[model samples]
Target: MSVVTNDEVRRELVEFLDQRQPDVVREWSLLRTFAEQRTVDAVGGCTELLNSLRRAARDGQEQNPAAAGFDDVRPMLRASAGGGASRRLDLLSLKEPLLRLWWEHRAGTPAVTDGALALSSAVDALRMVQLEEELTAGTETISMQRQQLTELSTPVIKLWDGVLAVPLIGTLDSTRSQSATESLLEQVVVQQAKVAILDITGVPTVDTMVAQHLLKTTMAARLMGVECVLSGIRPQIAQTMVQLGIDLGDLVTKASLADALSYALQKTGLAVVSADQG
Candidate 1:
């Protein structure tokens, strides 16, 4: 019997796929492994995928499969058809047809066995790429969402003609503090306000770090030509500040947002009294 090498088997498998492209595509499209029913062009995507597999089969090895093959086609795999992070299940559906090709030659010539191994390696490499893409995309989305939440949580609202207010409602972390300060300063300059209020009624706790963030925000507002009124300093929080020797250092403060708003209205020469007062 003539000895057949691994390379010969791989070449034959590649040729088989090349010759049967249409049939393979049709068969792959009908597999039940696909979980996501996408609107992708099935024929075109399957054709491109097969083309990658052929290149992979030509250059890839069963020992180390993730090195090449699909590297050049990463953009299409990441953004189109079944290659996106969201369509990983759909990508998994592709493995069924490739596995069947291996089954077809499992009991045939030794060359067929070698070809099947190469085909299996190429498919495994694509799986690795898909996992990496999904992880990267998931991390990026989380980072973007955190940034948006930080900005949206510290909304600066106009309370009066010359007054703006920032109502803080969560932990005073460094990121949120910086977001608050930047927002408050910008609005102070844009609204040309004389008074700004930092209301912390919803703040759950007070610590040295929280005190420092509050002071920094007030100082920044001062530089923008707006006086800051710290409000909603609950009794427990005030006691903690004193216990910790945290100083207000001549910064104006009030017991509640209502008191702070009253101070703001007076500073802006506006009065809100009941009609019964007259």
Candidate 2:
């Protein structure tokens, strides 16, 4: 195969693009309708890509020009990913008009053929870069969502002036357990509460591991000068804990939230008296 000089390739590409300017404009106009909500202006993007291709041919090195063009297009590609547009289809659609023009201007010439191959290689490089950008964007989105879920799963609610309660729901894995403990301890310091309640009414079962998690949380709260109360112990859970020989040591336990709250209020030197009693 014969190699074509950079100058020859640049000349052929320039001529092809100049002759097909109107057709390229029409293609972009049509594509703009599909990308209306996207930040990437289709017509401007097409022009930029063409200019990059021209520079690559002119310099005989595709990386610099191609990379710059891809950088310009990266944000647009990320926007498209969020908006349900197919990146591969967009690339193919953009390439069609230019490829058609190239084929028509210098179909049978060996030098122009090599030039066409180089142009195709540049387009493929742009695609690879776009894919990488999309992957990074996706990973970032997942990390944010995970953080939000953690916050939601371990909500610390203020029950009174000097009491905070954390209601645990669903499974109690090591990760969730740790998060709940940290959140409770932080709220203890922030609210200056003397009492912290861990309610497990929504918990379906109690096992050795679950008991251990509760013990650890109680120990942590004690270290912060706050007493911890465990509530929502159903009959089944109590039976399970007893059968499993899970000793909760000195931790206070209550059968219900109301009982726990009543105890907390008493510890804080506040009493709820009925009008009839008075």
Candidate 3:
């Protein structure tokens, strides 16, 4: 009734051959012997299958000419892809049935024509649904890849008290730095935290441009009434920052996450729970 149903039948045929039934076992044995004994051409099986289908159609031609026409066309329709020529063939596959329905209508069988039209419409609708599912899956895969890239490139961590520790783990070229700036700002506003500690310890080096971007981000945080701290500066990085003449005097810089946490806690008017306090 449908291409899907026909595909299922093909699968069932393959499965039937695999089950090794007494009748099919003889056929399988012959095929195995043929493959073992002779130097068969690569496409011999395809050619034989096509020839057999052609002979079957020819044998049925005298019995039912219309059904033979449909059988003759089934192969071409099955071989068609969703390409231009295949689209034409798919429509042509149903054309013969529609033509028969037209003749039947003239013979006072309008119900036959109605049934054929409904089946044809149903097949076309099913094709559209399959195409839509393929497109949606492709779109979702791309979206997931983008999400994974975002997670890998940007680092986010939560610290004690209300502070969030975000470490810039690699080089912050202008594009990545911009994304980081926006993502950090959004998280800070959403969390409503008083402190955001950006630890750059994992950053191997710093350039003037990256330092400027950091300055801009820290300034933006101040405008939003949130304190932003730079932490985890190795000696080499500190030297680079100073040599590059990048002024971070307006912002607080800490030697480590612990120091940054202490500074943030003091600024936020909060104290860490010591053992005695507990």
- Ordered by TM-score, highest first, the candidates read 1, 2, 3
**Tens digit of lDDT per residue, candidate 3, span 214-257?**
88877877787788999998899988878888888768898998
lDDT of 2: 0.76
Please provide the root mean square deviation of candidate 3 (C-alpha atoms, Å).
Answer: 15.8
- What's the count of clashing pairs in each model shown? 0, 0, 0
Cα lDDT for residue 61, model 2? Answer: 58
Kindly provide the TM-score of model 3 when superposed on the true structure, using C-alpha atoms.
0.48
* RMSD from true fold, candidate 2: 4.0
Worst 10 residues of 3 by lDDT: 83-92
Of 2 and 3, the candidate ranking higher by lDDT: 2
* CA RMSD per model (angstroms): 3.3, 4.0, 15.8
Ranking by lDDT: 1, 2, 3
Per-prediction TM-score to the true structure, in the order listed? 0.84, 0.78, 0.48
Candidate 1 Cα outliers beyond 4 Å, as residue runs: 1-10, 33-40, 61-68, 71-90, 102-107
In candidate 2, what are the lDDT values of residues 1-278, reduced to their tens digit? 87777677777776766677767656654663446524445666566655655555555555442355456666666765665544433564556666666777688886567766766776676667667767777888898898788778889999999989999998887877899998998888899999999999989998999888888988989999999899999999999999999999988999999999999999999877899998
Task: Give lDDT for model 3.
Answer: 0.56
